[model samples]
Target: MTATDVLFIDDDAAIRQAIQQTLQLEELTTETFDNAASALKILRPDFQGVVLCDFHMPGINGLDLLKAVQQIDESIPVIILTGQGDIGTAVTAMQLGAYDFIEKPFNQDELIELLKHALEKRHLALENRVLKAQLRIFARPGPRLLGGESPKMKRVLSMLENLVDTSADILLSGETGAGKDAIARYIHETSERSQHNFVAINCGAVPENLIESELFGHEAGAFTGAEKKRIGKFEHANKGTIFLDELESMPLALQVRLLRVLEERKVERLGSNVSIGLDVRIIAATKSDLKSKSERGEFREDLYYRLNVIQIDIPPLRERREDIHLLFHHFALIAAARYGRESIPLNKQQIGLLLQHDWPGNVRELRNRAERYVLMGPVALDEIQSAASVDTPTPQSLSDMVDAFERSMIQNALQMCQGSIKDTMEYLGLARKTLYDKMKKHGLDKAQFKEDADHDGL
Candidate 1:
């Protein structure tokens, strides 16, 4: 639990010191400010504390300060300290959002009790904010999967929806950065165990020596530096789901123990004989083919079969070419909202470059580029073009080659006409509908290329 501080503001130096000393004896963290102005300067919207202010002061009295604090964060409780016969002023303070009021020469016990209640209210408000944020991440409809109209993506979404209610173990195979973990999370969030913990661990990240201890925690004194008993990921995820990313990296020795736990539905902590029953659903992900590894004797065939009850293979970004534009726009919108920036529109040339690129890093790479576009704006175009040019491969099919040539010609005409639709259509010698259709198909936005009307052209 985080300790909440008390901010005390009073013009009188003696009153401020006395209150500070009293709070110190009660083991409460307190900050004393001489005036309301100084106190207001330090208060923030996310402040986890309560405020105490004198009813009358030289500048910005307690009532004004109460309104200001409420504007910053209504959750922070502000208590007013009034002198004797100031009952009318105290009533006004309450109307202006003061939490409570205490008369001068107030009893120490009463003051402490009021403060304790205020602190508890502040703590609950902060906790509710955090939980609401978490719920928003999983409860939103559509775009949670970050998928598109591509057939491959549609199949993935269908599989996820079908498995949402099942307790079957799942195996997700995909190229690195293809959003395997995201699929795992989507499954958990939409499943019956949505209310339980969704524990995730990257098998390749933990060191070989400590991986066992991390997965099946240890009793106190199980090993050096093991000062206390720890709950393992499996136990933490009991009655919910556990996602093991990079599962191919787990050692063969651990695989044997994992298989036993899966079969028996229980785990034995290191240095402990007692077996703890578990109701954890395992979702394992890997970039490598476990079947091939099993054939090569690198992986246990039995464990592979156990985990492969249901398999979901996510397509790489290059294979889902049509989804690139939709995904880029999606990530751009998210970045814009997060960083308080406008989503920059992509010009014909930039859109062409995005579609032609091989995206070896897949969806993750596209998301990063979108974030950079939001942060750096037009400057990111040069970087995107450079990366795409380096990775763009030769067209292997006639249709692909024709599409590429058509996109290039359209981009050239749009640029030459300074983004005038009529001029571009005449320049390309194409019908108006044909030009518009191609522009939409190629994800080109002519507005991005438009020069200021005051100036004819660059």
Candidate 2:
């Protein structure tokens, strides 16, 4: 669990010192403030902690500080610490939204127990807020792809939008977990056929013997265990979309049938002479090169041509490294909601580790890690560090080395400036246009850098 810091504010230096020692013994992370004004400076709406303020102070006493803290984030638990026989003041503090009041010369065990409860309340409140925000994101028009202003993603989205209303079959090419299925769903959602069913089947996962029946239904008594007529994916997706994931894994015999269906806009059920016309659009995705497979007789060249009418290639996560922070936070927020925890922001070192590591599993791997981090914070950090330390071949070409250095420098500058393009350009001593050109070339986005810094206080 991620620890929440406690802000202890008291006017008396001796009181602050004593409480600090007590809190340390309790193994609670805390910050001491001599005055309420100083304490309020560090208070923020997103602060993950509780505030403990002295009831009577020279300036801006506990009651007033409570109000200020409420204005920032009413959910934050602010406990009032008062002197002995201050029951009236403590009661008044509770009415004004103070979590609980503890009288000085307070029992150490009771105070610790109260602090633990307050911290738990604060943690729950933060998790609720995160969940609500995630719901708002989901309640938007369509499924989100979680892309920032990176040029590569923007272009891909643009292409998808352009093909949304078209009936042409789409072939999505990218590494595994690059969100080809998501892109397919997005196309279906934004298209005119969204009201109809959108069927999906993993070509590689289905048994070769049953793949044909799965794609184009089996009639009654078609084969053994074919007791009744059933609708296939293609028929079920009539006037909608059918996504064939891992298209390269489809059997060669099935490829011929798929091509015929694409050409004739119809399908024949197993053991049935009648052909059913289809108004469904097809979206095929593959991690392998279908053209190369076709050349090697592993896949049909005619079928490849049929599906490749409108190809959409999704860039892997490594190619669009600048969006890593943004994507990580997006998935982290989701994980936070799923696991009922607050999303831990990645520090500069963590972000650097993410950028340095080669994501062989792509966006899916990043998302899984984000969930793990939400569930087990520092443990995920150790895993990332370990991954970063793995040995990889160094760039042998001078141009490749220069490019690597340039990308790293740009990332460093962006990190330093918190993703402000103007500040980053100034820090890097480059013209705005030059910085933009380089950023575009390297698939870097300044906004994402700033977001990363803001997320974890980098």
Candidate 3:
């Protein structure tokens, strides 16, 4: 929607043509629609323009259209076009939520003036909506998502906003430091489930044998270390949400039981036949490509499909470079407050370095740098130069950082592929020769990545 956008609806062709020409002369984009139904298709909650419709049209009249538009977004300005006999109806439309009414045989200048005012109002409404959303996202008492205006981040924020009030199982995919944890927390804290518990578990950190006990708590004397009855994370998160981090690391054997819980919405303690009813929203985060892993038989395909009902991909910091300054300032403010230090602003050269650096660790790395800068001084910015992967950074850090990032990516791919060079190449989109060359360059052995699941009790 643009500044000059106008949705003009009138059954009269002559009147529609006249209005379109008038608005065009006034430099307005009039999208003429004879039927209200057609115009309704284009109308969205975030429409940034005014609407004009004739009162006594065919199927849906101006009053009915006004009601529908209000339902979509009450802030939209709907101007009704009425005749002399329709004055009473026009007043009724106003009471029903119309912005203003225009009489037939009206002066063109007055009509243009009213539309200008309405367009300004529409623009202000949209601006205020964005401002309010930002305030809600960043003004929370606890740690919040470092809000930004970058296009990719804005889409992510918009999707998060829509999900806060809904109880949909969400799967978040991102790199290790890409703020998936923060996003999960943000959703739980801002939603209606805020009063309930938000249980989080790192699937990869727990040992193989005890992982089941940790998740599906046990009864007294159920296992070697079981003493008293205990509740599982799912039980504790009843009527709330449970975040399963590092989901790809979940063992294949446990995945069958996990799938049962998700499908049944129930959880049973170990050594107990009685099933406890559960009502928990599941939010799983995975850094690895679960589909690829499942295809390679490293993860359960059924369970992967079950948890992937709705997925949100968190963009890495390097992809949203436009937001560097905003994120830096946001973290710096929090760091300064915590460290009891002044929030010294970065100079042009320092800011340039911050922008130039390819942030491999995403928000976590930036937050760490901000904290260091607050605790120390300008020398903290120098750490970024030493840690940066780009050429503008120090020569010592540049090659080392790039090589380290590349090595880690290859190692992770190999690990996920279970030492299959073909699968690794497919996953990394690298040629066979190139993959072998890099493996040799990084001194990586395929045998090191292959794990014996049975021996490891996974």
- Index of the highest-TM-score prediction: 2
Q: For model 2, how does the per-residue alpha-carbon lDDT over 116-195 read when each residue is reduced to its tens digit?
A: 78876776677567658656755653334555444577788878778999888899999988888778877887899999
Q: List the residue pairs that clash in candidate 3.
A: none
TM-scores of all candidate predictions against the true structure: 0.60, 0.62, 0.56
Q: In order, what lDDT does every prediction score? A: 0.80, 0.79, 0.79
Q: For candidate 3, lDDT tens digit of each residue in 1-458?
A: 13336899999899899999988776566889989999999899877678988988899988889999999999999999888999999999888878999998898999988997887787657655654564465465334566654568878888888899999899999998888888888889889998999899999999999889888888998988788998988999999989999998888899999999999998889999999999898999999999999999999999989888889999888766556655676577556655577878765467667766777788888878888888888888886677565455433455654564566567556644545576689888999899999989877777554321111000
lDDT winner = 1
lDDT of 1 by residue, 359-395 (tens): 8898888888888999998787677677665664744
Runs of candidate 3 exceeding 4 Å displacement? 1-143, 387-458
In terms of lDDT, which candidate is stronger, 1 or 2?
1
Candidate 1 least-lDDT 10 residues: 449-458
Candidate 3: 10-residue stretch with minimal lDDT: 449-458
Candidate numbers sorted by TM-score from highest down? 2, 1, 3
Q: 43, model 3: CA deviation in Å?
A: 34
